[model samples]
Target: MNVEGRTIEEDAVSAPPPDLSEWALHAFCLGARSSPHPVVAMDDNGRILYYAVGGIDMDRLMELGLKPNESQLALMKAYRLLTVEDGRLTTSFPVVGPQVMGELRRDIRAISADVTQSIRRDSEEMCAELARRGHAHHGYAVVFGHAVDGLVWEQLRDQLPSTKLSLERPFWNGAFWAIHPRRDDAAGVNEHPWSEGTLVSVWSARIAFELRSFLTESAVGRLTHNADGVLPVIHSDDSDELHRHGKLIAERLAEAILCDPRSKALSERIVGTHPGESLLIFAHELIWDLMDCLVEATPLVRPRALDNGSAPASDLRQLLFIRQ
Candidate 1:
């Protein structure tokens, strides 16, 4: 089947291979003792089906040819990221190929300039409030970023058209991208105590690869180690932080509208509900223009994190994804 002017066969041929070195570096930073092999599965027609890790059975594969183990498949299914339909193992989530990505990038960039401005205003206000409250720690910034995601979800979920396809809990809750590290058995591997950590970025499913590339190229955020893992922090003093932060927020908002099921439903509903209107223009209106109306009537505050006498920074750090 053709998608976004490209055939599935073309996508299979054009899709870049997963970067092993990048994954290895990420795993190493996470203090993983071992790393799982990343896997990509496709159908006979060259339609990409799954992008995952740790479903391969090397013992059975080397002996009897390559195949996924039944036990591992079952576990994936349990997570709702994979499914068995008509005796075939299939991906349960959406995957966007290069063609669609190109189209989305073109469409998004057209309105991203304005959207970035709106996001910058809001973020500045948020940052200013944090500073006034003496809560301008990087941890609070991270938490507020995620809280924005949740706020967006809550506002748009009910307005969106409903779909029968159920999303995985992690995806539904906006925590789909996660890093699982193996235990670090080797001692004295890390010279600095805070150097041992993992960096994770959260976004919708389809644009996972693209978003990673964007973050890498843009250098939007920096990683800081904590007891749990590494968190990406954007410092206010950095000259380009606001510009990059605004752009990153705009890109993530576009990803949600185009790729996330719930937000995509809203986009579809908007397009269908209003005929003879440009999707990009209307989307910009619905999101950026109406930002104030969409915001919660009552402002949200994490009292415990703010009130905690000891280790408020640590508390805020832990609060990043705790609500999810």
Candidate 2:
């Protein structure tokens, strides 16, 4: 909490949800601690099931103009920015709600329980798997994808040594996900919708752990699955292959940049130049390869923050390396 516009973390343990509607969101929760990165449950149609912890509280935080503090942990169940610190976690989405108050109640119970269970799962099965493979990384859950799985996440943990991931799930007011518990229903579609897009958002974070603090940040992307809304399960054996596959995706994107009929125009618009921008286009699309290679990814991006705010773009200016 801030008193006189100054940090008074002296009593953070005693801090309750801000009585105010505003909130102060933080950066991505890279694996530096043992808590669930808030999760967002969505149905087959891609609408949110409920705010596991609640995004409105976060909107309120932003209204107060507090930037994301990588060292702080007081946050809501949002994937807007995946980061955790000081035992707190924050993720985000829009203010798209009339979110059933009862659903919020259930989510509170489930989220609390799952966060702990998730942490334990990581330390137990997930961490050991990494050690066995001579790898080093432990991932947490996100507000996307199917139920957070311990073994499945080990692959990503190994690939991104300095990474933390989260899986989202929401409890409906009085409904159950027809696909699985972790995946909730979308906005308009009932939890039992037929033939809708069954997809999950995959939020990836890269962390720089400091002595008393950790710097966490990530990009959000999607992975769409079948009609039942059940995300296809990717077990361990398929993990290494997925990493190589992402590289292949990167290569394909480079070719697409050269061959796509509108590639030249799109390149010019994005970089404000034409001839020298091919690499930029390739790099931009390579971000897709980065996404594809990940165990999961969000299929879409929310337009703007609920507060009409914008995220700080990573310094991609240096990612423009051209192939010799």
Candidate 3:
């Protein structure tokens, strides 16, 4: 029989069957790759969409008391993170399994430790200089403490190896709040915490503790209720009241860190077992404590004004509007 212009026997001899070696290699590569971590992504509007990972399903979510509405499912489908194939839910994304995650976590810890130490030392020096300049020391603790948290991420982010993981900084508002989600159980599906904005890391627990202290005890937070009317309706205004609020927040933060059991346990664990996990938390507390000690040891002098300029109130208000 003839096939196209060539006889069947001629075509067979010329093109022979392609070997399976290349196909076998491709299959092996796919099998050897690590699986991606299952995570839920949240948009600015607070809507969350899940990235399907193995063993997580609607039944599991229901068992855990979670009820994702139809709108959420529709949003997930829109983002292509969810799909129905043959009446089965399926999704695809890059993966890094538990073992790879552990290794990456270790690397992150090591780099974060070095960066945090350097920042702490710099913060201490800056506080000392401020004290020498006869600036009021009351607000330096919270200022430097919060600054250290941001600096740690800024410095460590570039040093760590890239992965598909999401690393978010502790949430903070310019005027008052510093928010963080509590840690979830390590072995569970983690949909609950994921929904609540918790990242997968031991450091998240530390961030939660630190932010909770600020939220509850800081003078700038809701506890003070507009700094007892000293602050303007616009919280971020650059006024004397804002400075006073900052000073009060610093003083309250210092006291809170020393008295909070969570902070104490973290400090104790720094010299106890698993120091690596507690290093950042301990460093954070130590920075605040050291600043407080510096304020107490040095005599207070007349304070000079520092630059506290910020975005215009109108511009800041625009952030509240949701962009379509």
**Number of the top candidate by TM-score?**
1
Q: Which residue pairs come into collision in candidate 3?
A: 35-95, 35-96, 36-95, 36-96
Model 1 scores worst on lDDT over the 10 consecutive residues at 182-191
TM, every model: 0.38, 0.20, 0.28
Error of 3 at 289 (Å): 19
lDDT score for residue 24 of model 2: 17
Cα deviation of 77, candidate 1, in Å: 3.1
Q: How many backbone clashes does candidate 1 have?
A: 0
Across 1-324, the per-residue lDDT of candidate 3 in tens digits comes to 211122324443452122111110100011112221111323311112121322245664455454667675665454334554443444322222223223333433433343333334444444444445333242232233223322232333332223332222112101100001111211010101222121111112213333233333332233224333321221223253333333443444434344455454544432212332233334343443343343444342111211112333322211111000
User: Which runs of model 1 end up more than 4 angstroms from their true locations?
Assistant: 1-13, 18-65, 135-147, 159-324
Residue 121 shift from truth in candidate 3, angstroms: 2.8
lDDT of 3: 0.30
Candidate 1 vs candidate 3: the lDDT winner is 1
In TM-score terms, candidate 3 sits at 0.28
Return the candidate ranking by lDDT, descending: 1, 3, 2
lDDT of 2 by residue, 135-220 (tens): 22211111112112212223223222223343542211111111111111110100111143322222221211120021112111
